[model samples]
Target chain A: MMSMHTKNINTHLVEIKDYFKVAISVDCVIFGFNDDELKVLLIESDLKEFKGKWSLLGDIVRPDEELDEAAYRVLKERTGLDDVYMEQVQTFGAIHRHPAGRVITVAYYSLVNIEHVELKLHNNELHWHSVKDLHEMAFDHKQILDTCHERLKQQVLVQPIGFNLLPRKFSLRELQNLYEAILDMELDRRNFRKKFLSMDLLMDLNEEEEDVPHRPAKLYKFNFDKYDQRKKRYLGIGF
Target chain B: MMSMHTKNINTHLVEIKDYFKVAISVDCVIFGFNDDELKVLLIESDLKEFKGKWSLLGDIVRPDEELDEAAYRVLKERTGLDDVYMEQVQTFGAIHRHPAGRVITVAYYSLVNIEHVELKLHNNELHWHSVKDLHEMAFDHKQILDTCHERLKQQVLVQPIGFNLLPRKFSLRELQNLYEAILDMELDRRNFRKKFLSMDLLMDLNEEEEDVPHRPAKLYKFNFDKYDQRKKRYLGIGF
Candidate 1:
C-alpha cells in the first residue's frame, strides 16, 4: 500500500512537469528620494506590445538563484550599488498580467539615495520618474508601482527605513519633506517635529543645512544605537 | 532594426520556456483562537521525504488561476470555510526549499474561528496544533510559521483582525486572552479593557457569559460599521 501511494506521488510530480511549469520574473520598484519628491526607476519597454511605455527594471529569475538574489541582481545591475535597502513586498501572478506566456513576477520595493545613483544603463535605458507624476506604465507595472508605494507609506510610519532615502545628516524640515512625499499628505510642521522628537531616536548633530536659500534649519542625525536598543517595539511608532 | 529586436525578444521568451519554469505553491497558515490558546491548522505530510512530519495546508497553484484565487481555493477545500479574512504575508523561493524541484511558495496567514473548521482530511490526516507548542514542520514551514506569527502579532496590534478568531460575541477577558495568545504577552486586565474601550469599535451585547465556573463577564460584539467607516487609518490603532 505504501509503495502504491509512493508511485501515485511520483506520478503527480511528473504531472507537474507538464502543467506547473511557470516562468518566474522579479520586477523591482526601486524608490529613490530627492530633496522633496519620491522617484522610482523605470525603463522604456522594448517589447512592441508595450512600445513607448515605461516599465519597471526587471528580469527573469535565474533557475539556480533565490528570489531575493534575483531582486538584488536587478538592483545592482541597474543602479551599480550593492548595499541598498531591499524588501519583497508582494507577488503579482494575475493570469494575464504578463503578455508572454504564464510569467509570475515577484514584486520587490527597494530604497536608495538618489545622490549615489550610478546608472549602468549600457545599451538599454533607465529613467527616474517622480512617483507623484508617473505616466501609465506597461504590463500592470503601474499597479505594481502603486502597491509598492502604499507599502512604502505604511513602512515609513512604523520603521526607520525612510532614512535609507536620506543623507547621513539632515534637517528636520528635510525629514518632514521625505515623509510628506511618501505619505502624500500635508502634515502640521510643529506636530510632525514634536512627534519625531518624542521618539527620542535622533541625535543633535549641532549642524545646519547648507546651500539653502533661507536661513539653514538645524540638522540632526538618526541615532541608530537608540533605535537598535528598541527594535521590536517599532509598532508603537505612528504619525 | 525593429524586426531584428523583435526576433531577439522572441528568442529570449523561448529561452524562458526552457529555463525559467518554476512551480508555484500557496501555503495557508490558518490561525485560530479558542478560549485562551492560539492554534494553527496543520496536516500530515504525504510526501515520503517528510514522512511523519506536519506541514501547512497547501497545494500547487494551477496555471490558469490567480494567486489569491488559488489561496481561497485551498482554504475552502481544507476547512470548508469561505469569506475568511486572509492576507498574503510573503513568498519563500529558496532554490531547494522543495525537495522535488524549484517550487516557490507564497505564504498567506488567515484567521478562522476554530468552531467552524470542517476538515476534509479525505483518508489523509489533519491536526490543530497550538502555535506555542508547534513541533518542527516540514520544509521551511517552521520559519514560515514564525514569520507569519510575528506578522500576526503586529497585525493584531494595529488592526481589529483578532476578532476574526473569536465568536460574534465575546467578553473583555476573552478579547484580552485572544490578544495575549497572539501577542504572547500577559496584558494587564484593566489596561487592556481600557485600551479596547477607547477604540469605540465594540458593541455591548447587554448580556454576560454563561456556563462558566467563575463570575460571568459582560459580552460584546465587534462594531463592523464603525470599522468600515474608518478603514484607512488602521495604523492609528496600537496597544
Candidate 2:
C-alpha cells in the first residue's frame, strides 16, 4: 500500500497533467473616439455557431508568446496599427464560456484616436460599433466589453489617458466633449477648464481648429513631458 | 497544395496543442498586522533547489477551480482560515520565472487580523515574516510580493480595505498605525483621524482598548453597511 505522502504526490502530478489541457487566450477591447462618441472595434464572428454576432478582437496565446504579446498581436493583425496604448484589465475564465473547450481569456483595453488610424479591413468584416448601441456579442464578450469600459471610465478620472483618444492638437471644447462622452455626464465648462489647466498637462499649441462651421476654439496639445514629471512627483495619486 | 485558409487552420491547431503544455498556478500573499508591524505569511521552500528560502503559499490551479477559488483554497489549506478578504492583484508570467516548467501564477493579496484568529500552522515550516525585513524569496516571489504590496498601498488610500488588517473594534491610534505600517510612512495623527472621520465609514463603538501600556483610546468599528450604501451612490470614486 502506498504511503499518504506518496499518494498525495501522485494526486498532485495527476492534477498538473489535467490542468495542462486548459488553453489561454488574449482578447482586445480596442476603443476609439470619433464624432464625439465612444466606439469599440469588433469583428463579425466567423464561428458557424455564432455567425451573426460580433466579437472583440482576440487570439489564442501561442506556445512562445507572452500574454501582452498575444494582445498586441491581435491588435496589430486586426487593425494594422502598432505602438498603441494598451492595458490588461482582467481575466475571464468561467467554465463553459467557450464553445471549443476550456479557454481562459485575459482581457485588455486599448485606446486609439480614430481619426489617426486607417484600418486595413482585409476581410471587410471588422468595424467600429458605437459603445452606446452594442448588439449581442459572441461568448462572454459583452461582459468583457462592459468590464473594460468600466475600467476605462474609472481610469480616465484619475489618469491623463483619455487624451490618447483625441487628435494631437485638440481644442478645450473637444477635450471636454470627449470626457463627457466617456463619463456619460455633463460638466460645468468653466470648472472643467480650470481643473485641467491647474494640472499643467496641456500645452497651448497656438493653433486653432479649421473647417468648422462654428467658431473654432483654440487648440492645445497634451504635454506628456510635464505629465510624466508630475506623475513622478505624485507617484500614486493623480489629478 | 493546401489552400491558404486550410493551411492557416492547420497551423492554429498545432499552435493550440503546443500552448497546452504551459501550466497555471496561484500564489497568495497573506498579509497580517501584528505588534505594530506589517507581516506576511510564508512557507519554507520545499524544492531541493531552494531549500531554506521562503516562498509565498501557492499551488498549481486545479483544472476545475476558478482562479479566485484556487487562491482561496491556498489561503485556507495553508493558514486554516476561511471567509478572509482576498483579491487578485496581478498575473506574473515571466517565461523562466518558475523553475518547474512554464507555470504562470496569478498573484493575490489577502488581509487578516493576526490577533483575532489563530493560525493552524499544521507544519512547522510556515512562519510570518516582517514585510519590511524580508530577505531573498524563492522563484521570483519577491517581485510578486512587491507588486501586491504596491497595490495594497494604492488601494488603502481610496478604499477602506486597511480595516481588514485590524481588529473589528480599533482605536484611532491603532488605525493610524496600521496605515503607517502598510504605507511605510508616518501620517499626521490629527489629519488621519480627520480624513477617516470625514469618510463616515467608522462607527463609534463607545468602547476603549483593554490592554495595559498607555491610556486606552476610544475604539470604533468599520461601518460596512454604510460603506456599501455610499459605494452605490458614488459608484467608482471611493472615499
Candidate 3:
C-alpha cells in the first residue's frame, strides 16, 4: 500500500514539474495527543543549512499546484495519511524569512486522531514532541509553530475542532483534560461539565473506558450533524 | 510636497526591491456609504478575457519590495493618494481562482474616508456601488471583496477602524450610522451611544455639524493615545 502511494505521488510530482513555476507552498502544524499532553509533528532538517535541527513538515511549491494541494501533498509524502481535519491558518512573509531566498509560506494546522496515524510511514527522522518542551527549530519553524498554537487555542474555544485530536470514544474526564492542556488553564471541572452538557452536542456512546485499574467513566462521540445545524445559526460570538 | 514624498518613497522601495519582485497592485473593496448603506470599491476590467466586467484593482508584483509597501504603492498609483489607511488582509491562491495564468495575489483593503477622495482620477470609470447592489466582478474580485468586508465588519466591532472611513470630526449619530450600514442591522441609538461613551475612546470637540439646517449634533475625534493602549491589549487576544 505504501509503495503504490509513493509511486502515485511521484507521478503527480512529474506532472507538476513540467508546468508553470509555482509560487506558493503550504506548511503543516500537525498536533497530536498522548499522556495528557499536546504534541506536534516535527522532522530533522535534511538541508545543509539546518542539518541536525528540527523543522516543521514542509516542501517547495510544485509548478502547477494550488497552495492547499501542496500542503496535502507534503503531508501525504511525509506521513502517508489522508483525510485529516485541516484548516488554513495564516501566511508568513518576512523578506529574509527563507535562506533559500524569497519564499512566502502559507501555514495550515491539522488535528489527527493520533492512534489512527501511528502506523503510517513517515520521514525516518520524524517524531512528535510535547509542545511544552519544543525548542529551536529550523527555518523560522518555531515562529510558525507558535502562530499555529495560538490559532488552535482560540479555535478550540469556539469550534468543536478539538474532537479531531481525540478518539471517537472518550471519557468526559479525558476530554476536559485535553481542553486544559490546549488552553493551559485549569478549568473548573463542575462549571466546564455544566457548560459542555448544556451545548447538547455530545452523544452518549454507551461505552466506558477499559484496561484501567480505577473505575472507568462513560464515553461520548461528538454529534457532528447537530453541531452543523447549530453552526448555521452560530455567529462566532462566543468564547 | 507630492514630488518630495514620491522621491522618499522611491528610495525606500529601491532598498527592498532587490529581495522581492515588487509588483504594484491594488485590492480595493470600494465601500459605499449611502443612506446608511454599505458598499465596496470596484473597477470595470479592460482585459479582452474579462471585458465589460467589474473587478478589484490588482496587478503583477514588482521586483524587490515589501508586501505592505507594494499594496500601498498600488493603491497610490491607481488613486493618486497617499497616507491612506490600508491593510494587508490575506493571500488568495486556489489554483483556478485566476484564469489568466497562475498569479498569486496578496489581498488588501483600504478605508478612504470617501469625503477626502475626489474619485475624479479613475478616468471617470471607477464606481462605488452599494455592497447590496454588487454583481459579478472580474476574476476572483468578488470573493476577495467579500472576505475583506467580513474582516472589516469584525474589526469594527472590536477596534476603532471605522474612524478611518469617517470625517475628521463626526457626530455620534453619524458614527452609529456607519456601523448600522456596514453590519446591515439597525442598532438601538441609545444603547449604541451608551456603549461608545463607556469605551471613552472618543473626545468631544465642542463643535457641531456646520452645514445642516436642522438642529446640529456635537462633533468628536477619536482619541489616539487611548486607542493605542486599547490596541495593545486587543492584539494580546491572538487575532
**Chain B in candidate 2 has what TM-score?**
0.90
Report per-candidate DockQ: 0.40, 0.33, 0.09
**What is the full ranking by DockQ, best candidate first?**
1, 2, 3
Worst 10 residues of 1 chain A by lDDT: A3-12
Cα TM-score per model: 0.92, 0.90, 0.77
Top model number, lDDT:
1
The list of candidate 3 runs beyond 4 A from truth reads A1-22, A119-121, A205-207, A212-215, A231-239, B1-35, B79-87, B96-100, B118-121, B188-210, B213-239
lDDT of 2 by residue, A1-239 (tens): 22322221112333345556777778889999998899998877766666778888887776677888888877877677788899988777777777666677788999998887777544526789899898588888999999999888878876788989998899999999998888877878898898888777789988888999899889999888876665343232211
lDDT on C-alpha atoms for all candidate structures:
0.80, 0.76, 0.67
Candidate number that wins on DockQ, 1 or 2:
1
Model 2 ranges with Cα > 4 A deviation: A1-15, A231-239, B1-15, B231-239
Question: For residue B110, what is the lDDT in candidate 1?
Answer: 97
Candidate 2 local Cα displacement, residue A188, angstroms: 2.5
iRMSD, all candidates: 5.4, 5.8, 16.2
Tell me the alpha-carbon RMSD of every candidate. Answer: 3.7, 3.7, 11.9
